[model samples]
Target: MRIIILNNFFSGTAYYCFKFREYRLFWIAAFFSNIGMWSLVYGRLWLMRTLTESEIFLGLVLTANLTPILFFSLFGGILSDKHNRLTILRITRLFFAIFTLITGILIHLDLIEPIYVIALSIITGTLLAIDIPARSAMIARIIPKEHLPNGIILYSIIFGGSAIIGPLIFAPIVSVLSIEYLFYLIGFCYFFTVLILLKMNLRLHISKLEKKISYSRSLIEGFGYIKTQKNILYIIILGVIVGLFSSSFEILLPVFTDEVFLGDSRVYSTILLLLGSGGLVGTVILSISGNHFNKLSVLIFSSICLGLLFVIFSRITNLNIALMIVPFIGLVNVWKGTINTTVIQTLVEENFRGRTMSLQQWSWGSAALGGLFTGFFAESFSSPFTLLISGILIIFFSISIGILLLSLFSKIK
Candidate 1:
């Protein structure tokens, strides 16, 4: 029996490894690095709560981390277009790995004050501003065009899966192990990611004409081009709306666990893991089959379903049923992530890919800000009501965006 189980596990692992080889080591490094990133997040948030015991403080810390993204994202986009993406990614990953190590040391030494956390947040956020754009732009370079959509779906799958699993593992580890050690685990993963990145031979091409343009012009031109794109605009606007309503809800997961679920850490852990499961399922469906479907229609239908799932999740009193429905959230997440990226990647010119992706990052950051606000506001009143309001808003927003998209696409045709 044991041998049978072990064989099954190894076979499943080998299958995924085979699928991932199409993009080579670049995607593997990214997958591991992403897991570390979320692990760090899980550690950071748990550490923050352990220290401050204030939800507001957590929100503030998140704000500090994201504020720089709002400012420097455009610059990062410009660099992505003007430089070698793989090289840029390697440098940033190394810097962040070192930072994670240093941060871990400080935590171990009992030097992790709020001010230090703030400083670390800002520095890490700045590095991410550059790294994220480069990473997103580099995706197209590593994979064949025919496989780009699958690559995107696979990217979402692993990323969302990692996001779920990282926290599940970290939370329990922190419960038994010292919280400071979690940072060490994160650093080690990051170091491994850097090693993998170093080994991957990838180069991004920037044309001479594109090089001649000023950085400011490159940044503005990308946005200008996107402004004239009907599909891109609709997607971005709809994405922002959904993000504003749902993105920050994760920040309050700890609170909901404590208050609604009676301070059970197991329940808290389950919520996050379940969310990841949903995302994984969503990504699998999209990658295997949804690529052949109409992208716009997928986005519209998924957005509506996502909103409804949130509503159902909001009303559930039973934990088991809630867990069952949580994977739907992940499914919607995969749909949103894949559709948004595929649309932009297909519509934008090669030269403008970085800037446009930066815009996507910006939309996320901006939505995070809104989400943070929504979190605090909802917490101040009632958590359940907050979830309800967020769900309703998402539904309304999706309907409006879908109708607008239909009208615009028709006119374009």
Candidate 2:
């Protein structure tokens, strides 16, 4: 039974993309690194509480970690276009280890301060801002174009799966050992990522014209490309809408279980488990057969379904009924995300791929900001009502974008 399971795992439906050595190593390297990164997020937030019990400082810690992406991702995008992406990944990831190690050392020495932690967060966040575009740009270079969608779905699986998997694994480590040791473990994970990246032999082409362009011009060109490419622009806008409404609702989950359903912590955990299970099912199905569908049509229909699910989910007064609805929420949401990313990669030019992707890097920050606003509105209008508005807005905008896309393609024809 174990042997059969291992065999199937090694030769799964998405194994076609995994056949490439570059992507395989890249995936393996990124998996540990991303897991560490996600797991350490809790450590950082926890460490902040140790430094200062003030909720304001804790909030600042998170803001410092996320806000840099808003401004620096553009610069990272330019760096991706102008330089060797593999090299950028190497440098940024190396620093990821370095800073992480530095934080651990400070904590161990009893020299850590809230301000110091916040400063390190800014540095780490800035490195991430630079890394994201280069890392994304590297995807096309490593994988075969024919299997790109499957490759992308697999990549998304690692990332999204890590968010749930990482904390669960590392949260226990932080509890069992010291939080400082958790940092050391996370530091080693990143160092291991650097080691794996060094071993991967990847050859990427760099254009001479890309080398000679000014930063100002390269930035301008990225915007110009997206502006002229209506599809890319519309797709990015849709991504923003999804991020703001659907992606950020995890913040409201506790409120849902506590206030709306009058349940306890176990119920909150149950909601999370259901959501994660749904996500797993959705990704598995998509990884196996998502490539057969028309990308744009799948994207539009998924977005609409997701919006409706959000509406239905918000209105659910019964826990069992909400549990059933939650998995479908996870399904169409993943469908929308997977198809959105695949569509962008398929349509974007190599030089613009990094920049085009960088502009979409608002996912984390936008979700954070959207959650705050949603919370504020929920306080006034109730969580259910605010979420209902979110759903309506998403549906309205998804259809609007779909219509714009149809019109644009019609004119192109």
Candidate 3:
């Protein structure tokens, strides 16, 4: 009976893989690219901590990394709509690879400094602002509309998997060797992503009317469409709230690890590893059962759970307890993000998908804004206190949103 169950599981997995064969290459590319991105993030944060133990400086680094997403993501959406998304992806990836290589070389020569790291982060952030809209918009092109939710979930799984694997690999390297080597690995991964892109043959089906609209006109139209769609607007607002409160956890993690846990790099990596493990589990669960659940309810419940977890996490002085709570945080994080993305992708029209996703990116950009707030707050008070305040704010906002949603549903009924 156990053998039969194992066989059935393998068969189901194979079938799912076969069904999404059109996205297989993109998935492979995303896996490597995501690993590189995570490695860069881990390395960047570690390096910043080493340079200055100031929470404010760490927050500034994160702000530099995410600021471009706020400014350029909508413009990227305009370009994605106007041009071939595949081409934009390829070009952006190439530029990012080049930038990574240069940074690695500079670090290898012992010429690295905090300002250089901040500058490079800004450049990478700008590239990501362009890359995200194009990459997200391209998913609809490669897969059938009915399979989009699965596709998005699968993509999130790749993301979660990379987050797990990247740190696991880089933690030891950063411990023994140098953070500079991680940059070299990141560059290679980006280059590998370019090769995978070269192998893909995707044809985006854009309407001639879509092609004829000016970029500025397209931007205005996208906003107008979003204004008309209350559901989409609600989701975006939720994203912004989550980004502002929940996402700041990462920016403040180093301080949390150092001051609270009285730990070193290994402990920090362990926390991140646990978080990624939880995210992986969450993604797998979502992939299997997400369609059976209401996406909005998942978002609302997860947000509340995350808020509670953050509050609990803030109070924990024990390393083991803090470690245990982080995985749950990761699980809720992936659940919220996957559901939100699936809903937005499903609701938006094909012509407006890029722009809509760009708006979503802006919601994510709220993390930078949050980092600034958390950084300043951490500098004034403490990391734990900052987290406590963030958690309370999240709980208040989530419950208010839930009540609002309930009222709207009753009125409609």
Candidate 4:
């Protein structure tokens, strides 16, 4: 019996890549693309930090990068539902690669300015507003419905794993070469993804009903669908809260590393590596566990863990303790996100998948808001205090919601 169970576990793990061949190609493309995106993000942040050394500037840049999602994700969703998703994906990736290459050349010529970076960020963010939703919606189209949860978990792994690898890969390169070269590398990474996607056979499956609706009308219907679904509504609310309070960690990390830990870029890289490692571990566990557990329960539990761990992470004065705790911080953070995304994807209809996922992307926008607030707050106060206040507020909010969710679950049970 134990042997049979073990065999099933291994088979389930391999099924998505082996049994679903097309999804494997899609997965590989997504992995490299994500890595490239994250490398760009890391290099951009590091460049900003080295140039300005201002917390508020960091916040502003991050906000510029993320704010487009608020304005354009719905449109992206509409396009995804109305047009060929693969084509949209290809166009956005190509655009990003071109932009990144231009920025690299300017930087190499020592002609790059902070304003140029900000402008580039806005352009990249605008493209991402479309790319993210389309890519997410494409998953359901590629993989069978029964295997979607596994596919989603695997996607999370790519995201989390890339977060770990991107920084590590770039940090050393930045140290040895120059920050300008990092931009070139990022461009090449995106180009690599485009090359991979060029060879794959992709088809966009759109329903007749989706084709009939006007873009604006389709967006409204998507919003209307989200309003009617309580589970999805609650999940989005929780995600927004988490994003608003918890997502500032990355924005503040350079400050935290320098001011709090008295460390340099290498230390910053180490902390991120640990955080990413923790996130990767959490994603692996969730992927292996499959759908055996209750997703809502997992979401609630991981959220509370995130709040508590973040609070502890905020107050620590010792570098060793901070390093030790950050992994758990990564773990719970990714765990919460993975479960939240899977639940939303599972509950949403195919017609509304892109829009619903776009709504979900708002959580990142909320985090962008958090970055702005944390930056100004850190500028006014201190990094540690800003983190402490944010963490405490998250704890209060999460615990309150967790109680309500528990009561609702009890009634359901």
Residue 28 error, candidate 2, Å:
1.0
Writing each residue's lDDT as its tens digit, candidate 2 over 123-185 gives: 998998999888877888887777776788888777557655654554455556666777887
Measured against the true structure, the TM-scores of the candidates, in listed sequence, are: 0.89, 0.81, 0.94, 0.94
| Candidate 1 residue spans exceeding 4 A from truth | 1-22, 204-209
Q: For residues 145-202, what per-residue lDDT tens digits would candidate 4 score against the true structure?
A: 8888888888888878888987787768878888888788888888988988886666
- Cand. 1 TM to true fold: 0.89
Which residue runs of candidate 3 sit more than 4 Å off their true CA positions?
A: 1-18, 205-209, 406-413
- Compose the digit string of candidate 3's lDDT tens values, residues 240-306: 8877887668988888888889988888888988989999999998887747777778888988888
Better of 2 and 3 by TM-score: 3
lDDT of 2: 0.76
For model 4 the TM-score comes to 0.94
**Best-to-worst TM-score order:** 4, 3, 1, 2
lDDT of the candidates, in the order given = 0.74, 0.76, 0.84, 0.83
Give the per-residue lDDT of model 1 (tens digit) for 304-375.
887788777778766678678877787787787678887777677777788888888775666548647755
In every candidate, how many clashes are there?
A: 4, 0, 0, 0
Query: What's the C-alpha lDDT at position 20 in model 3?
Result: 59
lDDT of 4: 0.83
